[model samples]
Structure formats: structure tokens, C-alpha cells
Target: MKADVQLLITADGSHTAVNQVLNKTYHSIHGAYQESQRVYIELGLFSAFDAFPDGPIHVFEMGFGTGLNALLTAREAERQQRQIFYTTIDAYPMPPEATSQLNYDQFFGTSYLTALHESRWNEPVEVNPYFRLTKIESELQALQIDERFQLIYYDAFAPTAQPELWETEIFQQLADLLLPGGLLTTYCSRSYVQRNMRAAGFTVTKHSGPLHKRDILKAEKVR
Candidate 1:
């Protein structure tokens, strides 16, 4: 089924899409760009780079909504001169019409955003010298991933919208996919969600969230 999306201007003047069927916004209404920058880029990617410090970073993203996170990561890779292998999975990939309406490119001053959405699915595409992207179209629970990653961006819809993705079993699968000392970060810091992560054998920590949100979760595979 094709998703019906409504374009919206977030607090920071960036565009975010709302899924009409699910009644959920693809990003925070407070500020889409700010939320992605703080949650995924600062808290997740930069922290991962600090932890490892050397080697190409491998990233696994649970939801590739809006392609905002991927675009930001690609820019970061080039700015820091870091090599990143990004693998993102999305069951409902947005169509070109919806993606083209987004104004994320205005901030970066580049055509990378368009290139990212235009890149073929289920195949690796080098967005730039420092960033390689592979977008997979599959349901997270059904997909089989053989490779492990150093960082994971868990950007799925909230538990209220998709509880199955937040279950202990699902988190266990993610934990299994993380290399030792690797971490997973998400915008959700709900107690039940943290409990599920702990149940999956992850060392979970809560951190300050972006605009309007109070806390977020960072779960590590310590063992």
C-alpha cells in the first residue's frame, strides 16, 4: 500500500511529512532538522565516532523516513573526513513527489538530498567519497541482516503507533546485531522501552532530548 503523506513545516522551518494512515509525523513538529541533528547525529553518530575513534563507521538505521538522517550523516562524513557505511531499512519508502517537497537541501547547500532519494534501493550507492548508502525495503521484523554495525539509529514510530517494534524480542534482535561496545540510540526514553532494552541485555542510559522532548535512550551492548 502506498503511504499518503502530508507535508508540514516544522518549528524550525524545515519540512516534515505526516503519514495520513498512521496519523504520525515523520519527525518532531517542534523542529525536524533540530531533532535529527541532536538525536541521531550528535548523540548517536558523533558518540559512536568518539567511542571507536578509528575505522570506517558502520551504521544501521531502523527507519529511513524523510531521508533526513542519512543526508545529515553523509554531510558529517565529508566534513569530518570519516568513512561511513550506512544501511537503512524502510518498509514504506516515500515516493519522489513527497521527498522532493522537502527543503532539507536549503540548509546543506548541496544536491546530496536529491541524490540520496534517487539512489536505488537494495544496492549500495556512494553518495560521496566518505559516505556509502544502502537502502533496504523490508519490514524490520522479517528482514535478515548478516552484518553487524557500530552504531544504530532506531527512528521507528513511537510505541503507541508500532508497539511490536519496541518489544523485547525486537530489541534483542538489534542487540545481537551490534558489535561489542556498539550502541543504539532512539528518541524514546519511556520506562517500558528502556525496560525492554535492559531485558534484551543492553546497558541503557537516558539523555536530554531535543526541543519539546524530555529524554531519549542510548542502549549499549556491553557484552
Candidate 2:
């Protein structure tokens, strides 16, 4: 179905999906690879490992998108020899052929990209010894899961593009699924979004953003 989605190369020469309907790219125009590394991996996943430094790290990604973040996290898990269970939800999944056209694997020098898309939805599949992925085909607002997460990669479309997913109530609901000290990271630095995270019982902090942006947000479930 997504066979014709325009693929645009970002600053770092990585491809991202351009949703013409929403007029938004799946990742930053500055650099899709760089953005994921900084916002999601460095601040989100790495910090979680630092805080816990033990077995079985759980991650919930709000958007599956290009699956760039998931692939990157999987490589990291293997390298660090840490056990990671990653669950990502996306209501509208891109066609598998579409994801294959993305240049993320070439840019990251990894070969696990195909396995990620092939992994079944709504079921946990072991991508490797250290990384397991559960791809849930559901909208963030409609998602229901009993498992809590130590890290959340909040990679939804911008509020201007998809306002409903960024609402206070939605953030509150997501926060309810987080373990205390869990981190929620996003490329968005909008004041109102941070305010929403705060309203949802997270302590929001501004972090150095990916290229071309001033700041991103990292919200912690403090209670």
C-alpha cells in the first residue's frame, strides 16, 4: 500500500518517508540517522542502561516509522551484551518493500534491518540473543499493554501534524505504563508538549537536540 511513498534523503544521506498527506518527514531533515542516535539512543536507551545496568531492559516506541531506531537499538543491545525487549506500535505501517528502500542499514553498517520488518506484529520475536522486538499494530491512543517499560521512544509525528497523540491525557496514559525512573525521549522540544509530560507526572528536562534543532525533551517518570 505504501509502495509509492516518496523517499527523501536527509542531510546525512539516510532516507525517510515523506507522508504527503501530513506534509511531514518520518525523521528530521537535518539527519535521520543523527537524530535517532542523539535523541532516542544516546539520551533514551543508553541512559536507561546506565540507570539499570542489569538484565532485561524494556522499551516501548510510540512510532515504528522507518524502524531506524529499533534497528539501531538492536545493534547496541548486541554490542553491549544487554538483554533488551523492545515493543513498538504503529497504526499505519509502511509496506515492507518501502522499509527496505531506506538507506539506514547502509548508513549504520548493520544488516538486521530486514529482520525487524519481518518480525510479526503483536507478538514478541527474538531478533537476536540480546534483543527481542514486539511490533504492535495499533495507534498510540488505542494501545493497551500490561507490561511496563524502562525507556520510551516517543517518535510520533509532530503535534502540528498529529495533535491528538500529543494531548495531555495521552501523555498521562503513557506515563501510567512507565516504571519509576523510566525515561521518555522525543525529538520535540515544544513547551506545550513538555507541559503535557509534566501534567502526566513526568519530570521533563531539556536535552541537547539533534542537528538543526535547539533542544529536545527527556521526561522521567519520577514517582
For each candidate in the order shown, give its overall lDDT on alpha carbons.
0.92, 0.88
Off by over 4 Å in 1: none
Tens-digit per-residue lDDT, 71-99, candidate 2: 99999999999999999998888887687
Quality of model 2 by C-alpha lDDT: 0.88
Per-residue lDDT of candidate 1, residues 41-67 (tens digit): 999999999998999999999999899
What shift in Å separates residue 120 of candidate 1 from its native position after superposition?
0.9
TM-score of 1: 0.98
- In angstroms, the error of model 2 at 59 is 0.2
